[model samples]
Structure formats: structure tokens, C-alpha cells
Target: MAKAVWKGTLTFGLVSLPVALYPATESHAVRFHQLQRGTTDRVRQRRVNERTGEEVPFEDVVKGYELAEGEYVVVEPAELEELSPGRSRTIEIGGFADLAEIDPVLFDKTYYLGPADPATAKVYQLLVEALAHSRRAGIAVFAMRGKEYLTAVDSTDGLLELRTMHWADELRDPQQEVPDLPARRRDFNRTELATAEQLIEMLSVAWNPDDYHDTREERVRALVEAKAEGREVALSTGAEPEATELTDLVDVLRRSLAEARAARGTGPKGGRSGTAGGSGTAGTAGRPRTVGAAGTVRAAGRPGTAGRSETVGAAGTAGTAGTAGTAGAKGGPKRERARRAPEPPEAVEDLGSLTKAELYRRAAALGVPHRSTMTRDQLQYALKAAARPRRKLGKAS
Candidate 1:
């Protein structure tokens, strides 16, 4: 309504629906002033010439590519526009994709697609309704603001939303970045896998967006309040999934599949094992499954389902991914993480008769960083030293 970023005609088959591509989402993130710790003086950052230390204006800054140390190639805006790949007024429908192909990670910017002209409304509705009915996504290319974008168009609630995505090369190589993948794949077992899966199934349900919140974001706000009052901002060590590389891949995969199935509420008690095998994850509370002839087709090892199930942790709701169940929706590479729970605490010794607070203090003094994660009962034994610290076997009294 304010001003369209790019004006174009959405083309599907021979139908041309004139459309306005407007930004679909916005962030209301808060900003804060950087201040000196003791003086409360505001700290300011400036862009300056390295050699002269002269402050430079924002308009004077040019985008540059650094090829080597202290070496850069500055290119002008006009020159960049001249070399732009896709520059047109047409949103070309290159092809349609199974919605599952798109990875949530590759999604960059989203634009709401609306018919630009009154005459184009009919064809626009046709495309939107068709995509919604078929539950398919349109894989297309469009030129916007001198840049070419790979876009995915989905029709939701009578409006078409086009999401711009990253190219194949733009995505980072995970295989290169993560270490010890091979060794971690060697030692996993079936029982752990089954129990983990059972745990997931026992707790699985629908994804209500309201259920998830940025706890870190909320904590940051609380920290700000603490800072305003000049109180000790007690920091949380922050819960992170322990990274123990799996020693076995098969058990890893088996347990993961079971966990995902468990969250799926695909219990064999509710239905036959035959009905539950591949389709066990069907009937999730959020977004109903699009059943195929055999059953609901399962996407192998989706993101949250990775062996890193702890990544979602309590965020794992009882529901399915809704329309997002298809993992390969947009050429996003697929990888599986081995999801396993943390190991139990080591057994403690007897002769420990202290209050909980005192017991915790003893454990902290003994150098356990993960003490907070341990239960109070477990903490009691963890703090105990076996057999009253009996030094050497022969010299002990």
C-alpha cells in the first residue's frame, strides 16, 4: 500500500497477472546505547579511514570485496546494476516443487504477491487457489531491485506469498565445518535409540507458534532490567546439548526415527504396526498429513529430527510440521543429526547428611561445571566421596 519494492506480472502458463511485490514481514527488535561500565558514558562507534583515522560518513562508504590482506576492490553501484543477472518486470514460473524441498534455513526475504491491476485478479486467484488445492509450491525466478532471486510461491488464505531464497552456492557446507562426524557414527546402540524414540513419541504434539518464545531474548530484557537497577545480573550457564559424537550411525538413525515417530503420536497401540511403520508420524496435531496411496510419505531426517533432537528440546510440540512436512521442498540439502538425551549422573557415596544448599556448595567447590543440570537428589550422591577418602589400600586406617 505504501510503495511497492518491485512491480511485475506473475506468469503461470500463458496467464499474466500483474502483481506488486511488497515486503511481507517486519521486525520490532529493540535497540540500546553502548555505555562505559563505570562512568555510564555512552560509547560510540565510527567508520574511519584506517591510515588517517578520519571519520567517514555513511554515504561515503562503498561495498568492497576483500581479496587478500589489506587489499580490496571497490565497485560502484551503477557498475553493479549493469552486471545484474535478472532485470525484468516478469515473475517467471520456472517450475513447481514439492513444498517439502525448501529448507527453512535458505529462506531469506518474503514478499506478498498481489495482483497489480484489477484485470489481473481472476488469473491471480486461479494461480493462488490452484497452488493451495494441490498443496504444491511454485519454484520461480524473478528480478527485483537489480538482483535475481530464486523464489518459492505459496498460496495461503487467498493471498500469494513469494519467498526469496539463497542460491545453491550461497549455502554453507556443513560437511566441511563439523568435525568427528565419522567417529561419532561408529558407537551408537539400538536400546538407546528405542528409548529415545519412545520418549519423543510419548511427548509429541501440534506446533502452536504461540508455544515457542525467544527465552534468550526474554532473558536479555530481564538482564536489561537488572542492569537498570544496578543489581548483580546473575547469568545462566545456558543449557546446551552435550556434544558426544555418536559411535554408531545405524542405532543413531534408528533412535532418531523412533523419536520422530514418538512425537508423531504414531503409537502401535492406537493402530496396527503395518499402519504405523512409515506412516506412524501421520495425524500430527498441526498441519494434517497429505496422505499418499501407501500412507503419509516420510521425509528422511528433517532438521529438528537430526540426532540433535535436543536442539528443539521442549520446543518439540505434539503436532506435525503442517504444510512444512516435506523436507526436500526447495533443493535444500538434507542431513541427519543423531538425537540422544544426556547420560545419567555418576553414583555418589554415603555419609553425606547436609542441607541441599550446603551439598550444592560442596559440589561447586569440587569443580563440577554441569552441577545446575543435576537434580537435588543426584547432587547429594555426586558430592559424596566413596569410603571416606581412604588414601592408599595398604596404608589406610
Candidate 2:
């Protein structure tokens, strides 16, 4: 088990519970040591005095704030300690807010809060249950390591999760830094929009993180291994493909939607051949294809376009049915059957009624991807979408 990083008491209203904070996440990125290019000697950094050109002892190091260009106010360790706030062991909750209201950008680091002693377990569970039932997170200010942090405490997986947050003033507006952003709205063709929506629906599946892989890390490791074995490694110049200019938006969307449906084994096989610009060309079948923002198709697939053999599973079927019911209301008997179809379980309907932690648990159970980083609303939407049924596509006349 990981060791606790902080020990403190959590207090709200008249209740107090002893708790210890444990880091909830860790980084596993590969590390490299600094060494001389030719020699194996490890590179080392040292602290030295600029004036005396002598090494500085760790104990003698003191912090200084620059007053002007050449002047600094030197602060000693003892003086700094005296100026610091008194160490407080209590984390006092100030107020509570709906978890959805908190912006995800503000969250920094997260730590799990565990009961410090067996005696406090009951109180700890009480707080967790209260936060979960109320679907609210408690806001608090905490001081640690001589620095104060704004934090939010919420219940997750039956435990308390405390996340430090950036101050409101720390956030920057992107519009101020970004240049040449579109100022005026551009109208989109209705058919193009409908096609895009269809493509999204066709490609939509339960989030399974295992389906993704970090190829960069694998390539990096391979390069390192090849160099260690004294084997030749060929490197490629990183060049991006030239951008394509789009003429017809609706045609491109239709082709792309057809391709996506085909990839998933729902659309017709064989490519549609036509002029590159006004009438887009649907390249050969069974290839990994992408429809660029400019509506250009980059096709590289096999001979025949085969339907995707993967099943949507039970959760996916539920999500697809729900979605189809909402979209196919105008279709005669099918619409009535869809309307009469059972609604999603009460738990799903009351998603907003549960805490973020409970929502996360539900997402995990439903195989939602990236649940850890998803906002509450995103999770709810994904769950709702996953519970709906996929729409059936008709063959072209």
C-alpha cells in the first residue's frame, strides 16, 4: 500500500474526522540521466555562489526576493518560518456546491482521503455518504508545506477525493493569445450536418480504453534498444501531408459517412468514383480512411469492405435503442414501439442525482472510456448515448 503524504483532521459543522491524504495518481514516464556525449561520466548540477565562485552548502541556502535589478532581500530560514502561518492540522470545510458547477480546468492534483484511525472510520464513511447523497463537493482552503491551496473535497468510490485547484486569476483567456480566429459564423448545409451526425452515431461505441495504445512510447523504446545493440536505425523527416481544398461540403460528408458506416460493417461495399472536386471520389474498399476538415478522403484499405464483426454488447444495445427512440419518433409503428420501450433504469435517469464518484462507478460498469478525466456532464451524456440503439441505414437508390 502507498504511504500517506499528509495527516489531518477534517471538520465540517460540529463533526470532526481524522484522515490521512494519499496520492491518488502517479506518473510512469521513462526517465533519462544526463551524461557527457562521449564519456559515461554523469552530469551533475551544483549550487555555487556567483561572487565567491565557491560551492554553497545546503544548510546555508536561503531564499531571496529581488527588490530591484541588482538588489535582493535575503530571507533566512528562521525568519521565513516565523513569517509563515502556524501549522494547522484541521481541514475545515467552508461550503458546498454541485460538483457539475466546478470547472474541470481549475482542478490540479488529486489525493485520496482515508481515515487516519479505525475510530474515525464511521465518521469518514458518514461524510462520504453525505457528499454522495447530496451530489455536492465541499470547498476548503488548506495550508501545507508553507503554501496555502484552494481545494475541493468530494466522495469517489466510497472514499473522499481532495483536489487542489488553481485560483480564478490564474486562468487565461485563449482569445487574447490566439490569432486569426474566425469572427463571423459560417453557415453549414443541413444535409452535411445530418450526415456528420450519422457518422458520429455510427462510430459511437462504449469507451474501452484498452483499444488505444501509445505508439510514440513504443517507438522511443525500440530506438533506445536498437542503439544499445549497435544496430542501424533509420529516421524519417517529420513532414505533414499537404492540405486539400474542399469544394462541396455535403458530398464529402456523405462519402465520409458512407465510409464510416462501411468500416463498421453497416454501409454498402465498393467505392463511388467521380470528379475529385464537385463530386468526390470514394476510394477503394477495406482501407483505413479519414475525411479531413477540407473534405478530402485519404484511403488506404484492403480489397473488400467488410462489416465490423464486433458486437455492441448489452450496454451498447440499450444506448442505441434509447437514441433511436429519440430520433425515430416520426416513423410509424417503429416509433410507437420505441416510445413504449422501457426507459433507462432509474439509476441512469437520476445520474445527476448521484455524486461524481457514483457517476464514475457507473461509467466504469458501463465501460465508458477516460472516465477519470471526464466531466460529470460528459459522463452522463456518454452513458445516455451508450444506452440508446443505433439507427439502421437504407441502401442508396
Candidate 3:
């Protein structure tokens, strides 16, 4: 069991319940130590007194606010703690609001909330049920580690989750920050718009997280292992392609649509009569493929479909099929099993066609897990699952 990061009283209305908060997520990034260049020695840092030129112990250091250049206002830790009497120990809910009304961008870190005392479990469960039923999040504020935080408490999968949020002022106006944004929508030929929309439809598919992985990490691991085993590593340099001109817009759309259709084994007529049960995608072949990466090929198509194969690229490290690329954990390539059936082309015209970022916003609103790392397909899958009603067990009819 993970230790709770915080223990406090959660008060809403006249009811008060002891609750504990635990971090809901963790980082999996590969960490590296700072090392001197061309040497194996590790680099380290220390806090020192500037004027005295001596290292300072943590216990002896006090926070000082610089009023002017050299003028300082020193405050003791005990004094700061005394400023907020019960705030550090209590989470007081101000009110409830529809979850949909809150912008997903404001949500920051997420934590799991549970009863701190075993006897208060019922109250905690009741709160979860109420929030789930009402589809509202409890807005609250609390202090921790000498800092106050704004949070939203909601329920997911019968569990209560608290998410820290950013203040409204923290958000920046895009008009001021972003450059070269189109002032107004440019009028394009209807035929061109239709072609582009059709192209998007041809490339649409269901989200599948299992189909993707961090290819860059895999490459880095492979490089390190290869050098350790005395294997030769080859590097490639490719020129960047020229940008597409505005006059070639329609032509590019038509070509891309045709290529996507052919890859899916569909004809130019846009029918779903391709190989691999019409589920196999071109280039990716259900399993994601990178343009320049591992030198391996795997059998393509979902189970119960015709056997087919596609060659993975062997050039440089680049060009992932989608959000992430699929590769084996070991040195050799691996075949992937297809888990989802192909959706009708009409799905492209639905919510499935939305960008991954847009889907993520929706997923955040629904308290979906792993939303930050989810691929576009995974986000769509999570959204569907969240919206699904749970099955109730009863006597067999």
C-alpha cells in the first residue's frame, strides 16, 4: 500500500469526514545522473553561504525574502506554520459544479482520496456515490507543504479522486502568445473540403493503446545494449521533404485518400473489401510501424483474418506511424495481436475523428485514467468505457 501524501478532515455542509490523499500517478522516465564530460565521475551540487564561502547545512538555512537588492526579510519556519491555523489540516468544500463546465486545461495533478479512518469508510463511500450520481465535482481548497492548492473532488470507478487545478489567471491568451494564426477562416473550394474530409474518414480507426509504445526509448535502450555487446550500429542521414504548396492541396488530398484506401485493401470506390478482415491498415498493419527505425517485419492482420505481412523500415530513428510506434521489447521484431474490429467508415465522421488533444480534454472531464499518456485511440476507448453502464447481477431469467 502507498503511504498517503496528506491526511486531513474533509468538510462539506455540516458533515466532516477524515480522508487521506495518495498520488494517483507516477513517472516512468529513465533517469540519468549528471556526469563530467569524457569522465565517469558524477557531478553534485551544494548550498553555500554566498558571502562566507562556506557550505550551509539544511537545518541552519532560513528562507529570506529580498525586499530590495541586498535587503532581506527573514522568516522562521514556525512563524509561517502559525500563520494558517487549521488550513493545513482541513479541506473545506466550497460548492459543487458540473464537471463539464470546468476546462480540462485547468486540471493538474491527480490523487486518490480514501477514508483515513476505517470507521469513516461509509461516509467516504456515500460521498463518492453522491458525486457520481450528480455528475458534479466538489470544489475545495487546502494547504500542504506551506502552499495552498485549488482542487476538484470527483468520483470514478466507485473511487473518489482529487485533482489540483490552476488558477484562471495562470492561463495565457492565445491571441497574445501565438503568432501567425489565421485572422479569419479562409474560403476553400467545396470539392477540396469534401476530398479532405473523405481522406480523414478513410484513415480513421478505433483507438488501441497496445498498438503503440515509446519507440525513442526503445531505440535508446537498443543503442546502449548494442554497444555493450560489441555490435556495430549504423546511422543514416535523410533530407527533409519540401513543403506542399497551396495549389497542390486537392491533389495531395486525393493521393493520400487513395493510398489510405489501398493500404486497407479497399478499392478506389471506397468499399471495405480489403484483406485482413478489412481491419488491417496500410503502413501500420494494425501494429504501429515507424518510417525509419528497427530492421524487422512481422505478420500482419488481426486473428481470424487472412495472413499478410509488412516490412518495418531500417534507415534512421524517425517517422512514427501515429502517436507512438510499435516495437518488440527484445532485439528482434515481434508480431502484435489485433484486439479491435474495424469500425464502419462512418466512424470518421463522428467523435472518433477528433484530434487526440480534443479527445484528451473529454477524457479528463470524465476522470479517465492514464489520460496524459493515452494515444488518440486509447482516449476514445477510455471515453466509451466511462460512458458505459455497469452490469448488475440478478437471478438468471
Candidate 4:
């Protein structure tokens, strides 16, 4: 189990519950230590006095509020500590609002909130269900490490999540920051707009965050591995982006739509032309030849008397039953083939190397209960346990 970053009492309407907060997010970015040029020695930083050029200890450092150029008012730590909110270690809910009212920009960091003790689990669960049913979030102020935070407490999948928020004044004015935005009264070409919308529809796919990955991080790791193996790292210069012309917008949209349709294996009329057996290319006698992941060709097998499927092996060898049916006399009536369900995730032998995001995905696929609150190790253990077959109980002797 992960240690809680903060332990405090949550209060609302005279009811107080003890809760522990655990950070809900982590960064997977690769990090590197500072090193000296042309040397293997690590570089380090230190604080020093500008006038004396002497290193200063952390204990001697004090907070300073600058009022003007070259002038500052030094403040003591004790004074700031006394002024911090939530001195009693409490997060009192100021009010509740519909979660949709909160803008995405206000949400900063996320943390999981759970009952501090097993005895309070009932109250915690009640609160979670209540928030979920009401579709509202408790807006509260929290103090941790002498810093006050505006937080939104909401429930998701039977677990409460607390998201720290930026103050209203902290948000920047987009209109002021961005100078080249199109005017609100600007008119757009109706034909070009329709083409763009059509292109978007053609390219749309289901949203699955697991399908995306950090390519830059993967490249960095590959670079490190290649350097360790004393291998040359191949580099490529990508083609420069072509400048788009507004006059050619419709042509560009049409080209993009065509490319998307081709990538998705759809014809010009947005229809697929594959056999009912599988999505493979056209085969002889109107029987589709399926290609397996291992480069094996599978000739669609007709249902045998024993109701068994004759599959092709990884060496591109076809089964006797499959070939006989597929190579039958021409002009034979088309037989209906059974459609298979989507393939399940492949069994993973080693789960320790996977990141938390990947483990979460696997847990979700395995239908593990209460996975939102589980740590990475807990998720791995749950997945392994779920994969185990249950032993049948023997009759008592």
C-alpha cells in the first residue's frame, strides 16, 4: 500500500470523517542527471551569496517578498506557518456545485481519498455514493505542507477523488495571450465546412486512451540502449510540411477523406468489399483466405460433421478439411460463416515491468473490482489471482 500524503478530517453539515489522501497521478517521463561536458562526473548546483561568493546552507535561507527592484522584505518561517489555513488538519466543505460547472482548466492535481480507518468505511462509502448520485462535487479548502489548495471532491467508480484547483485569478485571458484568433463575425465557406466535417467523420474512431503511447519516451529509451550496446543510432530528417492555401481547402479535405477511407479499408462509397469469412483480401472461388499474425494463411474451413474448425499452422500449411472445401468446384453456393467475437487480451507472463496505466487497462479488461483504489502491485496481484483456475472442492471424508 502507498503511504498517504495527507491525513485530515473531512467535515460537511456537522458530520466529520477522517480521510487519507493519496496522489492519483504519476509522471513516466525519463529523467537524466546533470553531467559535466566531456567528463563522466555529475554536475551539482548550490546556493551562494552574490557578494561573498560563498555557499549558503538551506537552514539559513528565508522567504523574501519583493516590493520593488533590488529590494525585498524577508519573512520568517514561523510567521508564515502560523498564517496557514486548516491548522487543525481539517478540510471543511464550503459548498457543493454541479461537477459540470467546474472548468477543466481549474483542475490541477488529483489525489484519492479513502477512509483513514476501517471503522469509518461505511460513512466513506455513503459519501461516495451520495456524490455520485447527485452528480455534484464538494468544493473545499485544503492545507498541506503550509500551502492552501482549492480542491474539488468527487466520486468515481466507488472511490472519492480530490482534485486541486487553480484560483480564478490564476487563469490567463486567452484573447490577450493569443493574437491571431479569427473574429467572431468571420464567415466560412459552406462547401469547405461540409467537406471538413465529412473528413472528420471518416477519420473518427472510438476513444481508447490505452491505444496511445509516449513515442518520445520510447525513442529516448531506445537511444540509451543503442549507446550502451555501442551501436550507431539512426536519425531521419522528416519532410517539411506543405503550406496550405485557403483556395484549395476543399481539395485538401477531399484528399484527406479519401486517405482516411483507404486506411480504414473502406471503398469510395464507404463500404467494405471483404468476404463474410474474414477481412482478408479476395481469394479463389470467392472463399476468403485469412492471414494470421504469424504470417500463416488460413483457408476458411466449412463446418465438419464433428463441428470442429480446421486451423492453419504458423508455417503457412493448410489443413485437409479447409483446402478441400476452398478448392471445390466453381459456382458453388456461398455458405454463411460464423462471426467470432473480438479477441481477448493476450496472457502476460511478467506483469511487473508494465506501468500503472497499462496495469489499470489490464485490470479493467479482467473486470477486477474496485481497481480504481488499487496500487500498481495490488493490481498485478489481483490480475494474477483472477487468471488462476478455481479448484473443485472434494467431498468431505
lDDT of 4: 0.60
Rank all candidate structures by their TM-score, best first, as comma-separated numbers.
2, 3, 4, 1
Per-residue alpha-carbon lDDT of candidate 1 for residues 90-133, written as tens digits (9 for 90 to 100): 88787897444455557788778888898767888888778766
Tell me how far the alpha carbon of residue 121 in candidate 2 is from the true structure, in angstroms, after superposition.
0.6
Q: Please, what are the lDDT tens digits per residue for candidate 3 over residues 1-397?
A: 7899999999999999999999998765557789999999999898989999899999998889999999999998877877775889999999997655576778899999989999988999999888766767899989888888899998777788899999889987766777864554446566566666555555443334444455456667888889989999986543334466788665554544433544455433322222432222223222322211111122222211122334323221122222111211111111111213223323434667788766765565455544664445555655665243222222233
**Candidate 4, which ten residues in sequence have the lowest lDDT sum?**
328-337
Every candidate's lDDT: 0.54, 0.58, 0.60, 0.60
Tens digit per residue, CA lDDT, model 4, 204-270? 4322434345657888999999999999999765433446677756554454443333334442332
Assess candidate 3 and give its TM-score to the true structure: 0.68
What's the alpha carbon RMSD for model 3?
A: 12.5
Q: What's the CA RMSD of model 2 in angstroms?
A: 11.6
In the order shown, the candidates' Cα RMSDs to the true structure are 21.7, 11.6, 12.5, 16.8
TM-score of each: 0.53, 0.68, 0.68, 0.66
Alpha-carbon deviation at 231 in model 1, angstroms = 5.0
Better of 2 and 3 by lDDT: 3
Instruction: Locate the minimum summed-lDDT window of 10 residues in model 1.
Output: 303-312
